[model samples]
Target: MAKIEPGNGLTSAVSRNILRGTTESLALTDGEGNSFGSDSELNAYTSERQTDKYGFIGGAQQYSEQSAENIPPEVLRQREAKWLDMLNNWDKWMAKRHKKMKLRCQKGIPPSLRGRAWLYLSGGKVKREQHKGKFEELDSQAGDPKWVDVIERDLHRQFPFHEMFVAREGHGQQDLYRVLKAYTLHRPEEGYCQAQAPIAAVLLMHMPAEDAFWGLVQICEKYLPGYYSAGLEAIQLDGEILFALLKRVSPLAHRHLKKHNMDPILYMTEWFMCAFSRTLPWASVLRVWDMFFCEGVKIIFRVGLVLLKCMLGSQDKLKTCQGQYETMELLKTIDTRYMQEGFLVREILELPVSERDIEKEHLASVRRWKETRGELHCKALPRMHGAKAIMAAEPPSRQDLRQNPTIIVELPLATKSNGEDKERKKTKEEKNGKKNSSPTPVVADLEPSKPPPPLKDTALLGSNQSLSSTEHDTYL
Candidate 1:
């Protein structure tokens, strides 16, 4: 991606780093499935040899993965064993992952486990030495230096079409902004990324700012590699991984996804991004989060694969729609009772998943996610416009808290005011004198202007209103 100059005039080095943040992270997972090392190794590798994924012209390391020998049997075996043990006894495995232990998550966790579970799952259970109390206080105030820019850009963009996030200026938007800014200040390194909004939004719902920041740090570090990148290749790579898994589990869906260039990662990105807030209900999100924190990143893939198969098997014929339509539909259906059933999780586990199932589930989920989002947003154009018009027409509340005080002012005392001023003051006092004496703000629901009285020549037996009193409360 080309660099867009930041409106904020950051120093050359700071701006460069911010621009390169995604590139730096992507240095770990380039295109063509070649990983230089874990994210831990990305800093050293990128610093020594600058540049990024798909930019390979003559780099030896970038091209080596294609020619590299198949992963050794022992390494694959250890990976399988490690993964199997985790699936069977998640609590035991996760206990070792964290310095301070957390219990296993519920049998099936949702996608909104971005905070508490994210931290626990990413080995961030222990207290961090940095930004303890400061992180907590960041929520109540305004204007944090680090996050103000990043947070402002994505106010409701992540799931802009979700009605829950549609209000132009409301509680959800405010809280999201506060939590994100706080986290950015708290972790100047991770700073803020475009993908952080969903995760931060989920955390703001469950936790105060400080804890949420720590939890976010943990998830980005341990559970997700794509979260903090410039171009977000981790999403593509992980989606490919899910695509591979789905093929093993469901061939029919695999063919569909392949036809449309769909992948399970598209459906599950929100799950990885915010622990599933975009996909699952709050209860399910937390439930899944509980397990996510207890298990590891693999659980995200496993549960997602499982959910895909379950959602597919449901109703024999999977629901049909366009790309966005299917994703939007899936988002709506994510909270249905069918998903909450315990047996579904067991069913996914029982499937041999032999590569083919994973591929199919991955594909079907891709289509479904696109459909789900379409319904959540684009389908609601009339309602979205209507809702926005209503919100705009309504009187705005006086909630400005960031205004600076101490402006120059030199108003004369009452005795010095002109007659017009005195008259105006008296009229204002008379208008408000009979109301409640309290100084606090008052909000009144107003009715729209009524039509002028009918012409005298055509008068009826009694005066009539074009609209009833109930109609006054609403507008067309």
Candidate 2:
């Protein structure tokens, strides 16, 4: 096979290392099939280089981890304890003390707890439990050839510079492959989009493959339906909403866009699709995600607006960008000053972009699109906004905590054939009079015993399938 190099507008410098020689590196295998290389090899390469906390090999190391490191260890322990308590009683905090939850999220979930917090926040834990073994089943099956081929090609392209994905066909890339390919199998209609690679790569960085797969599921189906779907109609609608909101949030920037006839799609596609994983500094990306999994897609909008405001909100700032190309370039290569986590997170939280505001614009945009362009090709399901809404729709139970603990573990595959295996084990246990060893069966906890009172801010919108439901277990 011919060697594929970086700078082809396809692969990256790190990926070039993987694609360097013979067809051997390109060959696929069953499990852990990426080319063999040692982390020691990658480490030696970066030994003299400056790497940020997330372990990207090089660059200016734009985001600082020193602030987090500089904190007293005791303070770090205290934060971890607080996060632990919150995770232990997540439903209570979500149901009543969501304001405090939001406050904690803004402060930033402890890095150690970030993965579990995200799983809980996105309701992926519930989805994972409700459909146990689903990921393994999908992993076992051969996915659509078309999607599988595309996914294989795109795996190395995601976060190629980061240690997790730096090695050729390393564990990081393997796990990333499993999550992305599993998603394609789970939601064949949506299939694979190149942008999802980075999103899944980020998730895998923080969580195990199964947990990461469910997290990706929640993102595609519950959080941003129609986003990765055919025609990407939902994103197009969101882009319009972002542009309309920009008119109010930053008129100068909005006018600058209008003056140049710059459509949001021209610049915002990668930003929105990847949720700024590719755009923002590493620390800033995590900060945004800390809120995003808790607050939903509105956080994405706020971050984008903040970037617009910082970059072109003023006449003076806009003066240098007189043409579309300059404006595009500025948006593409965001100023590092605005990329700092503290400044970026502060601006994002301070911005008054409410959920209602986004929904209102969405309604208007959808109506306008229908009147002008007719119905969209893809029909997106309505989604709960964030942790609060997701929890509101399907209240977690004490029994659930006992049965499905938050700590990551490989769940038993809940397939029909596995049911027989479970029965056999149950029968043997019963003969031995070890019935008590089995977990106590609880009443169906899909719907809360009492419906949660409506939230003050905005009403929860149920997706076509509730996160707690088992009917569409295949999807999540």
Using alpha carbons, what is the TM-score of model 1? 0.44
Output the worst ten-in-a-row residue range by lDDT, candidate 1: 378-387
Candidate number with greatest TM-score: 2
Give me candidate 2's TM-score against the actual structure: 0.76
Candidate 2 global lDDT: 0.73
Q: What lDDT tens digits, residue by residue, belong to model 2 across residues 372-401?
A: 888776778786688888777877666554
Least lDDT summed over 10 consecutive residues: which range in candidate 2? 462-471
lDDT per model, in order?
Answer: 0.44, 0.73
Give a tens-digit lDDT track for model 1, residues 1-476. Answer: 11223432223443332232222223333464233323334335445643422222222213233222234655544443333334333344333543222222333322222333343344333333333355556656665554686566566443332222333344445556766776665555456775677776655444444445656665665456435544444554456667677767776655655766554444555556555544543334455556555534454666676666655534443556336447435633543443443443445346453334434553564466466533211111111111112223332222211111111224343462688887776687789784433344322311113322232353223211122112221111
**Number of clashes in every candidate structure?**
49, 0
